[model samples]
Target: MAAPEQTPAQYVPIGGDREISDRIEAYLAKRDGVDKLLKISRYASKIIIASSLFESQPLNSKLKSFESSVGVTRKALRLGKFLQSFNALKKSSELKSKRDFMASIASGGEGLYYFVEQFVWLSKAGLIDGKHSSRFSKIGAWCEFVGYVGSISVKWMDLSEIGEEKERLRSESDENVRELKMMELEEKEMMKRLSIVQDWADWLMAFADVRDGKGPLTSPLLLSSAGLLSALISAHKIWVSCKA
Candidate 1:
């Protein structure tokens, strides 16, 4: 019997004169499998994926602290790159989209991180599972993964670029014929902006959903008290239109 033929990995093209783009392309060019594909974009190795984040580890002078959740920083380029690549994969034919390769495994709504983690995790580590050795190694691996990836995965985005929607209206009084007529005419426009604002809110909730412990409102954004559903409501309630 003959061995299965090697399918060549497609070149991942990233544009920009920046060094990070060059670095990402270089990582993609050498890698062949899903495991290699995913790790290339992680901002830090010790990022919490499998376990409940609320189950916190003691503050360690020895081991590194946990990484921030998404939206915690604009510099989380590894995650940004992984998501960006997922978008790019949609447009190309020659490159095997990660979805194609990972179709057998499921997301379980874990998104891109789950796929990357399956690739980066070690099978041998399973041998030590539930043992003291495993705990030590897990901590060490987190440190090493973050240290190894370095600045290649870091990129910054302006907050405005991250789905900003300017507020429009409902603040206008329904008084008289003309004001009411204008509000009626502009209701759809107001709804559209409201929808955009809601999308950001929905995303925040999803981020909260995937991680354990605090709700999105209380977590990265440090919004207090409000839980996910309430945050969703408040996102809509707070955005009354300013008259131009």
Candidate 2:
């Protein structure tokens, strides 16, 4: 007799908006206990959406048929649009002041963490492709966000260092006057970079919290991820300069 055919695992019925809202509430209650709850929440929401999209009979049937029939470029574009909608609120600019900017970047940091957690959940559940999944998108987005933040942090540190060097040069009244002038120029450039960094930082914070129904500005994961990117970039730059 032929071996019995293996059956696909049955999909569990997930609670809809009500369950999602309740989970969000529970997560918020323990927000302070964790370092980057906002970012984590963002990822969690994405995973939930992706899973729901995959499990629902109507949606999954449509998606599977579309995936098989569509070209790779078309599929990628569709995926990008799907992901972009989740963060559409981030493009707003109603709050532009420095204070508001900082608060916003902080929130973005938290959102990064939430997204990471969601990636993990989805991967474990096998709702998406493990090798080419939403996690990769999350990683890319995080790296880009953090890379900008890291650049700013490095510029700030570099400016501080250059400022001290310029002061020391000013105190010296020796034949190194020409060297002092060069140092001054270097300090000016460093300061300019720092200014740009600060402005970018403000923008990033605000971007994370922009939502239609929500208030502007918030994330710890975003902050940490950004910090990590900044550190890596700063280190890489320093290493390259040293090698040169």
Top model number, lDDT: 2
How would you encode candidate 2's per-residue C-alpha lDDT over 109-130 as one tens digit per residue?
Answer: 4345344545544553467667
* Cα displacement (Å) at residue 233, model 2: 17
lDDT of 2: 0.45
lDDT of 1: 0.34
Q: For residue 239, what is the lDDT in candidate 2?
A: 32
Pairs that clash in candidate 1: 35-119, 41-78, 168-241
| CA-lDDT, candidates in order | 0.34, 0.45
Tens-digit lDDT track for model 1 on 1-244?
9999999999765544455555445544432222222322222223232223335455321123223222122122233344544454354434364433232121212224423433333222343343453344344334323322221111111122222221222343444654655555456455544444433444444344434336435353322112233333333332322111
RMSD of each: 21.1, 21.1
